[model samples]
Target: MGVRFLHAADFHLGSQLAAGRGESTDHDETLESAVYTAVSRLFDLAISERVDFVIVAGDLYDTDSRSVRANAFLEEQFARLAEREIPAYVCYGNHDPVADAPTYVELPETVYEFDHEAPEEFCFPNADAPEARIWGQSYRDRHESRSMYRRFTPADDRIPNVGVLHTGLNPDGRRYVPVGRRDLAGKDDIHYWALGHVHDARVFDDEQPIAYPGVPQGRQITEPGPGGALLVELDAAGSCEMEFVPTSPVVWRSVAVDVGDESISSIPDIERHIERSVDDLAATTDRFDGTSVSVRDPEWEVDGYVCRWTLTGNGPVHETLGADPEAVYELTRRLRRTLAGRRPFVWTEAVRDETGPPIPAIDDLRGTDRVIDEFLALADEFDDAARDRFRDEVGMLWQPVDDHEEGRPDELALTDDRLDELVDRARERVLGELARRRAD
Candidate 1:
């Protein structure tokens, strides 16, 4: 019989998400709870699947300084796992740096949180004493630049050694804390290497099945898409099978639909185009049971499944649709119905400045030709580097204006429109310098 376990990491509880700013406090709590809920769901899976053990790669908490409520929530999940009698192994990632620190919930007898500096190995309960050694090291300090894997090697042949770590095989050189594939592959006797850190799910070298289960839920735009944990079944013979089971309450998606040449004379056509895009997400989910777009409060209800929508495109759609407040109203209503009570179905408005033809070929400015050229010439006098710095300084100086322009119409008028007056003064200064340089 193989050892089955759920491998997951980066459950940044207390870390705010797009839903944090939602109008529905209940929905916000529900969505956030969905992340913590995944832990129990996975534990339930362990019980039903009868996995010998469970391994949480790292980052159990978003930070060391968690709120009292958040800590209480963490305790609840730990208790649920204890109830199932399933054992859990954990290592601290960069986020949850203090592996040694103790908190409220009575630590589950089955839980083994790894130590920071050195690699600790623990064996599971099996008649064969299956050489399944779990070797893990923790994040003792915040910025551990040194390679912890250097201390790890494969287990004895008598054991089916399994190594669990929270490092990155960053394909690009620009990875945080830099770990490489060679470190994992070079180790002998290690049949399966469980990894974390990089949120994207990946397997390196094929020689050693090293994987990162990604995050349990999306935290930001970069972390968009469905999030989940990896279910790994290791046979007594040492061969392992892995499957990704998504357990996120709400899926984060950034979809861009092309509306370049779309003709939208009526609402149904617009609805149809959006329907196809939404249907695409349904097929991706493969469950076919989610919300559909409609123009009503609480939106259209279809079997309690709610999906979200974001429309994007250029061409006639922009001109025909952008200014129509009713279109936006109708679209929002339809989206709300499709995403009914899922709460934060629509996180952001789709950017649809796609109206009008391509910027016209460079043409002479009719009345302001001479002044515009002078402005351009003055703007070009400073090198690219200097101009960039200048632009940054200008942004900082006008920071108050930018901050106030978001929702207040009066603030927007005072900041953006009024700031242009100052900008003109700065432009004059640049032109004056240009003239002085030319004369010299």
Candidate 2:
């Protein structure tokens, strides 16, 4: 009664999209192996949906380049389709390993690799009924500027025609191989265009019903998002429908938290900030109808929030935070501990201090009453420079003066006169250090 098929492309097996530049090559290679897991998930999708056939548009590998392992994984995917009795039709995109040759890889017998020379019709003849026809083509090179569809004619008027390709549809004209809308539209043999190349999923030109399933998962910051494939279903009467099903085990998200003066006053505030960020991400993802947010706090207690925390920071915060400094460090550790088992939360110690201003100078004052006058004159002159150096120094200078005058009996030993002397000398130390560095 209907033709139901699963449409997907850009598997890029062993491509290592998740590979990182700073990571050891071994780690990148391990990430590459993760694709096999994603592929298995797709097989589950196919079996669960009970689709009659699966169409793989193109770019089956990250590149035409392959190692023994990549090739082996490729064979496994096709074999799985065959095991389920679902015929799979594969077309070679620019990155296909066999793009230039008719030679077959060790694929399962049920898998049909399309040709470049002409559109071949595959008739799936039901035991009790007539055959359903599907046509497909392959890209002969990495950049086939011309349309590969010129050779294909529609299926006989009696059969439903489905067309598949791996060429760039609306690709960036400058660098990518470009295929235009005009070229694909009004084609007689194409009922549905299962396309590939661009990694963002979308359906284009309702008249043609062409689609791009995007990459299954992101490889870098530029590609951050949920990555996966598409499932297409058609009725016995040949009416078609499709839905996107994500297969990525990991997700990437970018979160921005604004730090105002009030927010950084205490540990509880910082904890609340982080919690709110995770909550906001959850909300945004829900609104997008996407999977949960997976924080990647690489250099701080943020990236790889679950797997690893690459400690990164400047000055004190960078120095492997300690439990002695209030409860803030403990709070950070607690957040990491609490979010460990959560799928959407990943705690990385990539926290870097964006704190502004520079370190201030401490006082070098000692034994002399006349030092008060000297300190007063210098303090007036250095006040502006002290602000420019580090606000902490200026804040420290005023603390003793304020404390003693307030008659706080438990305060550290110091008079207003002594405090002024200390303040002036501290300013000189900071300025002198700056000058010394410049001199060097």
Instruction: Choose the strongest candidate by lDDT.
Output: 1
Using TM-score, give the best candidate's number.
1
lDDT of 2 by residue, 233-275 (tens): 6443446666677666555554434433332544455556566
What are the lDDT figures for the candidates, one per model? Answer: 0.58, 0.55
lDDT score at residue 374, model 2, on the 0-100 scale: 59
Model 1, residue 193: C-alpha shift (Å): 1.0
**What is the lDDT for 37 in model 1?**
63
Model 2 CA lDDT for position 32: 48
Angstrom error of the Cα, residue 341, model 1: value is: 6.1
